[model samples]
Target chain A: MINPQGLMIVLSGPSGVGKGTVRKAIFDHPDTEFEYSISMTTRNMREGEVDGVDYFFKSKKEFEQLIADDKFIEYAQYVDNYYGTPVDYCIETINDGRDIFLEIEVEGAKQVREKFPNALFIFLAPPTLGHLEDRLIGRGTESDDIIKNRIETAKKELEMMSLYDYVVINDEVDAARQTIQSIVTAEHHNRKRIEQQLRKHLLEVD
Target chain B: MINPQGLMIVLSGPSGVGKGTVRKAIFDHPDTEFEYSISMTTRNMREGEVDGVDYFFKSKKEFEQLIADDKFIEYAQYVDNYYGTPVDYCIETINDGRDIFLEIEVEGAKQVREKFPNALFIFLAPPTLGHLEDRLIGRGTESDDIIKNRIETAKKELEMMSLYDYVVINDEVDAARQTIQSIVTAEHHNRKRIEQQLRKHLLEVD
Candidate 1:
């Protein structure tokens, strides 16, 4: 049996689009072959956050060095803290024949797209912009003005939906998860990938 | 809400690859939104064959007229009989927002590709050439010589796999069906289609 290269899945959307809930739902499925890609971050570890599981914690200097070395697929600085997807980890995971998932934002996704255009980019869209606004307001963590700002940011982020390979509506968590799972499964059977496998099979016989 | 255009799925493979079985399994799934396209044929229908369900039986002259009128997306002459895919029916079904599955052979698929490049072309591959040979033999209706010729034809057909969008191996009937169903579901969320839907939502001022 020829071992096919695993799919690289990037799940992203505007904040409060329920991406996290949808990701969790997909991860919870027992039959899905998935590995979550741990990103490197310069932000201090929050309470109960594990260094590697939640994120690969690094100092500002260390993160900058990685940047200098071109070790990241995409990186961004937020409030003087750096966050990025490590190129090495993604390459290793995909080469290991296991599908890897990256939960990222639009800007990070754009950067990743430049590096790996073949990756399956899925946008987890809220049912509507109004629904997205309601979810942001429902969180109760931000002031009304902040919520307003978040909504405005979301509109801009939503424009990135056209850049993705699939747009899964997060009307219901399970449905969105199922749709993502289907995308991954179907992508594995993509003809270009299968052609490489078949070519190998052809060579062995001749 | 913008009604997204439905997908046209072209299922093709070598003879005796169990395309019918796989297609049935997918259609049996309650949630799969599929409408089978009824092809028109000049060949005489056998006993108990319904006019529309089995095929749109047509006279040789009528079929030729349709060909001249460009009513068929693809048409082929086999043993003095004609078989074709009608363009109008497919267009109407897809415009109605329902996915249409076209079980066509390589030549017909190529014609469809010329007409609609975006149609999802899927090749149903056998586990191996030997497996395909065994399948033809197991059918027990063909002579040894006929079986040998069929196997040779299958080999040539397999080479066309590279032209398809995806290739699903028919090692197990149910699994193959599930994969096809997934392809259909996943294609519904393709980025290009969702962009149109999203654009409508973007223009709607709240």
Candidate 2:
């Protein structure tokens, strides 16, 4: 029998695997609803990006303050930029009956798993390593060295592919999006969720 | 991490609850593949149903013979009709990597759960008892006595809702289809699946 409970989908991928793009497509999905995880990052706000919406941009000092206070569920420093996922907000939303979505890097995703063992971890993979490299460069914002560094990071990420639950190849946007949709929809229909639906059903019948 | 090995989704409900219709929708789905569970029955075939396809319609003697030989995994008698899920077929399909879908009645679903505890059981519910009544009447094949028995059977079936894993209210055709789809997808993206996916992924990378 199916159990009915809300599921936590922890989505992670390397820098240029179009995780952001996939999220955008999912946000516009007609039948689904979600609460996005806003990360507290030490990285400088990029052009046109807003704090609290695009990212909760923090200074090195402010980020450290939160870390010392133990406010984040998982935190990491990438190229001197501190990033962390806030725990309370994500948990609250899920408790309120909405599935929480965490878009994080591999390390952070691992941390979340350690903490929330039931959370679903999905890894977004590019069609090929070559495609990932091209996507990083085609973005045009990063310098050659940064692009190269990201590629190396991607290799390490791919090595940790086993750490993810699902490897979604982002070859075709529509296909990949559908994959994500299928996966997420599948999660909501978890055993606990189904049991809940059944309980409601029995009550209605009785 | 998401598990790579797929899941077994047991779609169980009462007769005329549109389990077949829901299964048909899922079968026709383009993005995903599923395996249908073939059943063994002793009920004489009604017109238009095929053997080995609609059911492995067997005689009482043949079914009892198989049972005595211990060839059947699980079997039950309902309204003087003997029905069962053949062990060999389920094993073959499950090993083939597709989720096994069994359109079973409540008792049969419960029995299957005993044998395969990890199977995802999704309860297909008609919108209302009235709707169920209408559906049974719309069949136009059964006698009044059989129709009354089915309606009573449906009521008893609803009482078994708590025994199921998930309950999907199948009201409208398209909406119910989507709900079932979502439920199935969600189950595949569960924590255990994540663990399985991550393990397989590790093997692939290694």
Candidate 3:
């Protein structure tokens, strides 16, 4: 049987919801087989971060040129820095029967949804709104007003949880990582995705 | 948040696809938590098979009366014996926030689908049509004609694979069992089923 196209998995949630932590745990685990889609950014590369490994660093002009060329699956500007996921790598990886993982913000996730509606969208959620507030406060550098503002933003972002296919409560990083892995495994067994190949294999032989 | 209603998991497949073996492996595993809905049958109980353990052995009259009273989720007669899955046990179990597992025939699975459209339908499949034929032939008791007929029936049943939510290829009992377990875990995280409670918890706090 021919190999089916791989899944495009998007992990997105509200800011400070531990998406980065859970993503790190997932990649650090030896069982993870999917390749991470390195993001492109126009921000200045920080010390200890490699240009290609950490991100495909680009200049403002170069990033805008790629954007104008429609090479990004999703992109967003934060604090005057442009960050985007390239469309070519994702498409090539999926076509090669290898899953590609993307960790992006909510707005960028929405854009990917428009482009690849079938992509598996997992919303990493906080255990509770109170817990999210505590996490923001725990950062300690932000003042009370900024923490309150972040909580409000989180509320709005949490509302978008309905848009996701699966919701993994980030109460514990390891648990969230395991749930994500299980979701990916189950998706491969979904009948809608694998039916055609099984059908051809079963019926044609008779 | 209130515990969500448990999933109704229906495991069905073509005859001789080793559904019983896989189901046994699943139930025998320490991690299996779902309750198996013991089937009611009018078939004579064997010496070692205890009532309510192997099956809820009932008289033909009792089985027919239960059928008339709409007590069964699905029922069928084979070789002058009645067999069925009782509806009350499944309903009560799911209502108690516990999953209910039913191992039934494909036709019975189709009936359950009409009654409970949201139930998780898993179709166990042989590795290949040739493998299915080999399994039937390995049964030794069946004549060549019976084996051929069984293979034809299997082909027809495999056509119904599209009706399932997930298809588990029974290439190995342990692998199929693990896949089923993963599918259940993933279904619990499905956003459609858990979104309401999450939304209420998140939005109401603000």
Question: Model 2 has how many clashing residue pairs?
Answer: 31
Q: What tens digits encode model 2's per-residue C-alpha lDDT throughout A71-158?
A: 9989988766888998788878877777777777788888888988888888887666778888988888888999989888987887
Could you tell me every candidate's TM-score relative to the true structure? 0.87, 0.73, 0.91
Q: Candidate 2 DockQ category?
A: acceptable
lDDT digits (tens) for residues B109-206 of candidate 3: 99999999999999999888888888878767567887787788888899899899999899999999999999999999999888888777666544
Candidate 1 residue-wise lDDT, B1-206, digit = tens: 44457889999888778876777677777867779887899877766668988689999989889899989989877435687899988999888877788987676888899889989999988887777877878877667987887777777787888889898889899899899988888888888766786767753545
Q: Residue B148's C-alpha lDDT in candidate 3?
A: 84
Error of 3 at A23 (Å): 0.8
| lDDT scores of the candidates, listed in order | 0.82, 0.75, 0.87
Clashing pairs in 3: none
Worst 10 residues of 2 chain A by lDDT: A197-206
Between prediction 2 and prediction 3, the one with superior DockQ is 3
Query: Model 2, range B1-206, lDDT digits (tens) per residue?
Result: 24434466777777889887777777677844777777899988877888987789999999999999877657889878898877776777767666677776677778888988888878787767878888889878888899899989988888777667666777777776776776666565444445444434433422
| TM-scores of chain B alone in all candidate structures, in the order given | 0.85, 0.86, 0.88
The residue-by-residue lDDT of candidate 1 on A1-206, one tens digit each, is 55456778999998788876787777788977889888889987756668887789999999999999999888887435787888877888889888889987788999989888889899988877888888988877667887787788888888888789888889899989998999998888888766877755633422
